[model samples]
Target: MPRIPLVDVKAQYAPLLPELKQRIAEVLEEGTFVLGPNVAAFEREAADYLGVPETIGVGNGTDAIVLVLNALEIGRGDEVICPAFTFYATAEAIVRTGATPVFADIDAATLNLDPADVAERITPRTKAIMPVHLFGRPAPLAELSKLGLPLIEDAAQAFGSPAVARAGVASTFSFYPTKNLFAIGDGGLVAVTDPELGERVRMLRFHGSRDKVTFEYVGTNSRLDELQAAALRLFLPRLDGWNAARREAVGRYAELGLGELCDLPTDEPGHVYHLCVARSAERDRLRAALTEAGIGSAQYYLPPLHLQPALRYLGYREGDLPETERAAAENFSVPLWAGIGAEQQERVVQVIRAAARVPAAS
Candidate 1:
């Protein structure tokens, strides 16, 4: 293992282990495995926390998007506008619903969907707009709302962001292990302000049955299991605190003068800093230097989705999305996690300084 990892899940969960174990034990003793009381209780707590009317727990984040599309009745011959620079699952979910994903350019600074670009991409077939809170920076939801289309927020990276999950027509979250609010295993949810839409999502997650016997919309099986839901209940209350720690770590990186070596992610109050991404013309060199120093690092979305061989048929060429391509080529993520020490951040900056031939921080 590296001296520091990109995210230390073990460290994040260590403090909660005893509580988590007790929760798991209770789940086992209850004999309510799938979509049980724990799942319902978690859904209520999460919905309350997000200030939404309801939340429907599902199998994973990708399914949450698909469920919302199905609930909205968006399907074949429909178009959903989204950013191409995000995780492939965003577009993949749209395609899975038989809707074409219209790619839009992202803002250069926030690395989120540019509302202006989204306006240019709109058409009569545009049924919805999906904006990702990329790297925990809230997307321009207020501007996107003016487009007069349904807004579905892909908030997988930004569970604790202020005013994020509340703005969209519906929002999706992933409780993957690395997330600020995480479960021991995969879990996801869809938050909706509309109770009718919430009921539709709830039914869709459980094989389209309001009751087990009657199938309504031909929905797939995607319920969040009791074990995962129980674990999430333990973590949800602490999400804001964890997000604060992540923000603090980003501030420490800035103080260590890592920003002098490369462009650090913008320090937005709402940004939870899921990944402490930095942009350098020398990203490859910087990553290599960190690797040699026994540190963990990573690069995100190198092909920028539009240029991926799988997406070539979208008729997008190399330069179609300039900002997205630039980000893909220049971005690298360094070690970041809740409770990371200042010394660790300083060491990371020292390696970065050497790689970029910059003076050390005083």
Candidate 2:
């Protein structure tokens, strides 16, 4: 087998090259690079797709979180509870708001913020709960909502997920090159049902200005540029199709009969398989075998956020989160992407089986 990438970003653009290039050329010819009509049109499309009243485009995902939190007045000594097993962005956003990020343990199966565990962590200072839809499955939104704190969703990994019954006060998404809904460069949005909340995100992304010259809330510049917005538009129409492909690829992985040998992701509705993670006692061995076979694999969050060096000041030691620590130690993802073919998936199974020393079910 030849080399496989975790995701082929260039391959993603190739099928839609003509449309993508035409869009970019139009934007270039018009010379309205920043905060242009393309961005406005894309925002409207995103809102419609998300079933929300408004979607505010921004420079990046982190800024989307910052803007929403700022608009919600969740800064300066507020506490935002989130999972410790997710990407650092979740906690980093909370800290940037001058709020304490109270890390909670995740559900072992879903790898999402565990609602039961969260109840124990709430305090008088706890103002919000940020549940990451880790692995593109909706977080336990209904269970989390019963806690009665404001919910801010980190839907960065969940662009094409099936709809959840409930929504948070705000939800943010990333359009980084590798996401389900990707862009050529950094792009992001804050989606909201409330018109008032939508307006706050819109103003916050543009230096807190209702108009270009006037400043309203001491906000920063986080506008999504014309190129990224244009690129996103080209890809937007194909997002669901690509996600369906990803789902099919994961199904192929399961059909290889590898589940008995490793912990495979289940067929959960709303799961877009952002990473088709599997667990093994032989995690490192499987990863090494994939590397030797010229197949790509990854440990998406190997350390878990609380153990990261930057957050040591929070005083969380090892063994603090048992499920999170166990997950960090045992899971790795296979190369599952929109364009991955069955032959390639078979090769991946070959490598993993070799590492696990398991005979293929004959």
lDDT (tens digit, per residue) of candidate 1 on 1-362: 34988889888889999998999999889998998999989989998898888999999999999999999999999999999899999999999999999999999888999999999999999999999999888899989999999999999999988868877889999988998888888889999989899999988987789988889878999989999998888888888888889998998898888888898887776788888888888888889999999988999888988888887877999999999999999889999999888888888989888889543222
- Model 2 worst lDDT run, 10 consecutive residues: 353-362
Please give the lDDT score at residue 148 for candidate 2. Answer: 95
**lDDT, residue 121, model 2:** 96
* Candidate 1 similarity to native, TM-score: 0.97
Query: In candidate 2, what are the lDDT values of residues 1-362, reduced to their tens digit?
Result: 46987678787678888888888899999999998998999999987888888899999989888899999999988999998888899899888888889999988888888899999999999999999988777898989999999999999988977653147988999998888899888999899878898898899888889988889888899999999988887788898999999999888888887786788877777888887888877888889988988988888676888899988998999999999999899888888778987888888887787779643222
Pairs clashing within candidate 1: none
- How far out, in Å, is residue 126 in model 1? 0.6
> Model-by-model lDDT, in order?
0.89, 0.86
Candidate 1 regions with alpha-carbon error over 4 angstroms = 358-362
